[model samples]
Target: MASDKSTASLTTASSKAILLLVVFLLTHTLSFSQTTTRTYLVRLRDKVSSPYSVSRPEQFLSQRSIQRRQKQNIAVLERDLPVNPAYVTQLQQAGAKVRFTSRWLNAVLIEATDATMTAVQRLPFVTGLEFNRALSRPVRSGGRLGAETDTKFGQVQTAINYGTSQTQITQLGVDNMHAAGFRGEGILIGVLDSGFMNADEVSFLKPLFDEKRILATYDFVKKETSVYEDDSHGTSCLAAIAATADGQLYGTAFKASFVLLRTEDADSEQQVEEANWLFGAEYADSAGVDVISSSLGYTTFDDPSQNYTYANMDGKTALCTRAAQIASETGMVVVVAAGNEGSNAWRYISAPSDAAGVLCIAAVNQTGQWASFSSIGPAADGRVKPDLAARGQGTIIGNPDGRIASGNGTSFATPLVAGLAAGFWQANSRLTAVQVVEALRRSGTQAGAPDAQLGYGIPNFARPLATEEPMAPFVVFPNPFSDGEPLTIDWQTINANASVDATLADLTGRTVWQYRYQPGKLGTLTVPSLNLSAGFYVMTIVSGDKRRVIKLLKR
Candidate 1:
């Protein structure tokens, strides 16, 4: 997961004082139980005959969320409906403290004793319960829980002077995107990590408060609104995306709106943190966040039985992976770190990072070389894992004490790519979430030969935006076109009398097929006979000064 340092080992008196207050608040809110307690993920039966309706999505979803779904033409499915409130109340009545409910999964997270869970399972609305975490003693609420470690080595924006941060910003071509006036304005990024620490006090981040860009904050661990006193790890992650200090530092998406969420508990390692991530993801989706940058991951937990193996990285097993998939389906771009486990026993990418459609970021150094510590993977199912790379080593970041620092980890790299996603999407608003993911992949340095190490390699944000209007009038169909079939191009909306030049080139930029045509009244051009071998190819279409680049796979 994306956490660092011993949260309880703070040296500063101010940090200790803050921890005391957090401890006091947690102790007051939580009742101590002498018996062993376990958290269970309660899977609900269904949303049958529920008060909520897909037609009235406004009742359950925020207007912005509704608009995003509508914009993507995504239907509000039954699974999107809220879990029955009656079920939650029943669980509470049965002595289970309901912590969170996931609309997409139709489940609730509750902390309960075995006896209480027995009562909870008997409820007619309950389908099943999965054991998450067991607590032998009283709950460990404060002082960093979970181990998603990233080494401190570190640690910028656009026309906004990115002093020490310039290299990172330009490495991904984010500077060009910003120069094009797409510095993530109007985009909402939800950051899920351990804590924000003194985000409000950081000079570069104060604008988030002054400009009211911080739309919300939540501590899933403590069940509170305050996330400012937990850990400094998240402060650095946020700095990668939102910090703005001219010539000193700048985040890729400094102008974007934000919602800070504390999902990783830095003090303990447990499956419950994954559940917390699910809750945070659900919250981000409901809040209409355009992108989610989570630097956390789960692998081995405190309980050996709860540990995830490489097989579990298949994207279908981990709870957080499922949440990532659902969040992407809901029109939110999900970005996560590709664990810093390289050179370790478990060098594979972590869960949620393995989730398909999510951009799993790997770490690269100042010169764009792969960081030996950045995780590597073929996912467990043999799919390219680390979807992109970004500068992480010695990356510039803002500190809680109102200073700057350098850090190292896939943790920092993850948010830089997330920031790029926001700015790229803002510049190309017509693209769907999936399209956004693909555009970034296509812009990668190794897009044509993506592998486990760096997946598609580092992405150049300007590459995609500079290439074409993703939703242009021209359309190419049967994307993975089967061999021997005609390749059709529909330019129905293009200029009627304009001559179009279409060239299909192999991955190495070798033009294998070329077609020149003036559209018929119908504006359809078909290449009836192409004797090309099966492989990946790039197609460039030029009609006057307007050009479009398309990647194609022939089978």
Candidate 2:
């Protein structure tokens, strides 16, 4: 069953996926208990009212919806793409009937023919059009799973990415909590992946099982009596994310409980396979998953008719889109793998990963260079994707036979980050889903500025959430400074040759005051004592290494 991880020279990790698959079938393992399953009631509020109106649903993406709408008349369009609310306005103005509107995509997914499509394209502000063929019947892929050790489910790794050889997976942050012995005990995590055959038998996950932390696992793929029998991918993915050993490989969130969902169907191409993920995500919500980490994304399939062109990659183009959106709104941290189609002409991050609100992940090698297999992003809507990274190729995780295998893929990278997320969650359960997202982004290497390839850059838990006092003293004061009497900005000591610029800016493009200071200066820069109207102002210090911005109110 173990095949080389090569697929058309597709990229690295192809060989690794196979060897892990083979080791999976060879090991016979113990089973997991089916007792613990947390259920969450998924509630959707009215869109125009309440918190749901402003930030109810996060809009973190857009991609792919550019394909020519399929001309064939199909009944699913009603369920596929709902009528646009704005289109109703367009139709009424054009002397057409306005009946119903779509609250979802904010545009009408009309049942247009070739002529209608052409006419609609000519309409004003019609950003894009799509076929809405996403509503396919659900089909089980394959899920071979079993229970493993849950003993160390309480031990969380303090590092962002812990590699093999007992070294922290990342270089930047410090693991203060792990060092303090609070490694996420009693937290439950749900992992949705391909399959898990021998993962339960592996000794790595044995501790968690013994500790009774692995709540419950269901295989949506087979709709089976157990999730520990059909595939190896899910098991392997989970192992890397949460596995623990006796001075062996360490996981990110070792203490978190896990719910495993088998969504990918490596068997055949049917639009429903994509829909199955929707159902799985719904199930995940029902399962009360604190965190949902899926390394799955969709693009092309076996059926040419079902093939998704790059234009259709917009987060709104697929059935998985809504499901992913719903998952995010429900407050479950959703982490998805950016696809590995980077080198291919069809390469781009896949759907759901392109979905709004969830954190899309990219892969990076040990040397900190972007991996060639890691998909590039800027979702269809131009939002930076791959919000973070972890080790992919050469990432070491435990095998069922009590050994380790170095693997690769945005898949592996995803689990590693997911595990890190678990650790973050463990460190602070009071953190809301959005707050957690902000903290992760703010703690990244590229926090101040982000790009398409690595959204906010790598997630660093230690720095953003650190509890210790600042190493260098700094101050911003007199918030709500009335008429700018005198806004004093204090300076602090810093490294050699460091300089700072203190400036005050008004709402417009005008600068009120700008002052530069040397590294060791211990003085305050006063804003021009001008009688300004009530408004918002920005005071900032641009230092040699870092620039700090503080918002001031000019009352």
lDDT of each: 0.82, 0.58
Local accuracy of candidate 1 as per-residue lDDT tens digits, 63-175: 99999999989999998899988878888999998878989889998888767877887899888865534522223332221123333333222356677888999999887
Candidate 1's displacement at residue 175, Å, is 1.2
lDDT per residue (tens digit) for residues 1-555 in model 2: 135444545445667788787676554221111222211111112223122222211221111111111111111222233233444555446433332233333433233333344454566656553343322333442221111232222223434334352333443232443443435564446677666667677887887678777667766546664777766777667776667664446676677777666666655445554555665665565455667888777776554666666666677777576678766665667888887877778678887788867888877777666777777887877777768766665565665555656566777777777766666665545455665666667667776677766778877655522323344565655654555367666654544466667777653436867777665554455556766544345566676666666555444
Tell me, by lDDT, which candidate is best.
1
Candidate 2's error at 181, in angstroms? 4.0
> Distance (Å) between predicted and true CA of 446, model 1?
0.5
